[model samples]
Target chain A: MFSLLQQAASTAAETDTHAAPANAEAAAAAAAGQGADAAHAVEAAGAAAHAGEAAQSAGMPQLDVSTFGNQIFWLLVTLAVLYWVLSKVALPRIGAIISDRQGAITGDLMQAEEFKKKAKDAEAAYGKALADARTEAGKIIAAQKAEIQTELNTAIDKADAEISARAGESEKRIAAIRDSATADARSVAREVTAELVRAFGGKADEAAIDAAVDARLKGAA
Target chain B: MATEADTGLAFHPMEQFVVKPLFGDGPIYWYTPTNATLWMGLTLLAIIALLVFGTRGRAIIPSRVQSIAEMLYGMVHKMVEDVTGKDGLKYFPFVMTLFCFILFANYLGLLPKSFSTTSQIAVTGVLALMVFVGVTVLGFVKNGTHFLGLFWVNSAPLALRPVLAVIELISYFVRPVSHSIRLAGNVMAGHAVIKVFAAFAAIAWIAPLAVLGIVGVYALEVMVCIIQAYVFTILTCVYLKDALHPSH
Candidate 1:
């Protein structure tokens, strides 16, 4: 690289026709010391060095007064445009978008809270309704049990009365049989007594026989 | 170094900072569009794209570009509020303009062939001067002669107060000069060092180190660029606070 730079400087010194910039003069002097091809390579390097020098400015380009006016002018123009655009359009728009997002989030959170409350309310109502239905069911079951018990007691009482009435009728029938048997016996006894009397040539009294038979049936009973 | 072109290793670092007409070689009028103008215009377009068109959706869920815009907005907004207090918000638009412009200018200047507008002393001087002048005016408007109390050190002993006042007054006046130089100097120094390192690539023995040095400096320059922009803005806010509440 050093050799090539020396070679370019050597040629540029010979070929360069324009006024020498600072670095080029030093390069030209160094090339003079080396003393090589101050020949046709001169033409080749001439254009390049000139272009480079044209691209460069002396000293600090930062302090260049010639460009200051142009820089400041454009700077002011750009700032004005940026300031106008920002203050009027960009800032307000961004602020609004941010606030709008905040509002949307707050609204969503509030809605979620409301739904949670509704769910809680529904749960409570469901529990209350379940309890009420259970109580009503218990009441109905107790009432049905009492009604069945009353019906059973009435049926048993009527059965007992019918059984007692049949027993009384049987008792009366038995008594009547006993009385008829008594009368038959009395007649038989009287007949017997009269037969005995005829055999012994004595007559028996019917009235007296009836009385004795009656008294004997009564004693035997 | 200029003759090193034959070795394919000629690097003019300051040449990159030169302001030239973009169209043709001629005298640059105050209005003639140059590379400086081009980069400045690019900065504006970048700011617009990020802070304007990027936020076109205005979505509740911000896109990447919109989030970046909001982040910048919130950062500067909070800085102003923190330093200058609530009253300072009245000048938020002004402060926002300064921060965004400097930030974009610094970042854009880092491009391969881009010119750094913030690295220009003339430009930073104008920026600092605007802040200094505006704040001074605001101080007087807000608190008449009592604004001068900023220089008067009541905390000092009566015998030492005058000495402190003189120091305060000079430091107060030096604010704009230091403000402008600090930014331009840092950026210009970083860029110039990188260029010098790049020029070393002409020698084979040092080429690797030169490339590494360039990379390292480039990274640092990127950091310095944003930091300088931040420092410039924060200093402005401090000055504004002093003006708004000068009694202390």
Candidate 2:
């Protein structure tokens, strides 16, 4: 029987509790009689007999009522210990580990999502900045072009005014010069006519000469 | 005796199932430590090592052992949630305890010369009773009079309702018996069958075939161990669901 193999080494040889428990106990008692006291020996023998009877009554050890208490008791003890260990230490620790891992994963996922959102926001900002810069550059170019055009128009207007003023001054000077020349020519002609009339024995007519010079000049001679 | 004398072969496979003292040939008391205790202790230790110590790091990227522990946790957690819905998650730890205990017990019992403690009806009976009682109390507390609707199928024709109620009532009561027996029976039968096959190996002519049978049976038993544990836990979840939503 496995019972013998499971026995303590010292008690194994003393108790051959395999086939017939009563017989095994009797043999055990005989062996113990040499070493143990009489009182203890009797008690040991009796208990062994009782155990044998218990075993004898039930063909299957599982159905044996005698051992039910032991099995259940140990089972309860084991379960209680298991529950305490599990609930107190193992389960909670495992649960914590699991939840912690889960939390870690979720936290990472959330962070990744935040990062993606940030990236998207940055891209949008970059695009807006590019568009703003383009618009600003466009505005600058338009303003510069308009200012240069206005300056060119003013310069052209100033030059045209100066040219017109110069032409007016030149026209007045030419009129003065023509009048002087006409006067000079009229004096010279009067002097020549007076000299000729005096030489031809006739008095020079000053008023008439003057009137003729004036009419000829007015008629644009 | 006659059969043994005739063929010099006596195979009492049930003898292996006998509970005996571990230290000395003394009477087994309710508190005496036996092989049952040793194996159960081992199971406890294994759980501790895997769940507690293994997860000490609790790395975001889990270690191998921690991953295994997590896998078990996830599976049982999901099973409870799936079967019982959101409300059942409150009982996650309780369901987890049952699944781990039975799973470890079934697995550890496969060790050589080890006593299969879970093979005892008393042990499994207590486990099933705990679940049954706990679930029943929870049902009443949660649903009150509505819990009885589980047995009183309203959708049935009025004439057949009573018959169906009787049947449902019987089945409900039979849950613990079947639940306990299913685990113990599977474990015991597999071990016993393996032992019987081992016995056949004592004969020289059939030794090889018997050995092959033993290997084959052991392999199948290994699968049965996990599957039975799964079935038991899933059934517990199913029962919890019924208790939670008793109208169906």
Indicate which candidate wins on lDDT.
Answer: 1
Docking class of 1: acceptable
Q: Which numbered prediction scores highest in DockQ against the true structure?
A: 1
lDDT of 1 by residue, B148-204 (tens): 999898987999989989999999999999999899888888888888898897789
Q: Compared with the true structure, what per-residue lDDT tens digits does model 2 show for residues A25-47?
A: 43444334332332233343333
Give candidate 1 regions above 4 Å deviation: A1-58, A153-221, B1-11, B23-29, B152-164, B246-248
Error of 1 at B74 (Å): 2.9
Best by TM-score: 2
Q: Model 1 clash pairs? A: none
Model 2 chain B: worst 10 consecutive residues (lDDT sum): B1-10
Q: DockQ of each model against the real complex? A: 0.30, 0.29
Model 2 residue runs over 4 Å out of place are: A1-61, A192-203, A207-220, B1-15, B141-146, B196-215
Give the TM-score of each candidate: 0.74, 0.78
lDDT, candidate 2, B1-248, per-residue tens = 44456766656666666677789777777888877777778888888888888888878889999999999989999999999999999888788888888999899989888888889888899999999999999999999998999998888899999999999999999999999999999999999889888888988999999999999999999999999999999999999999899977
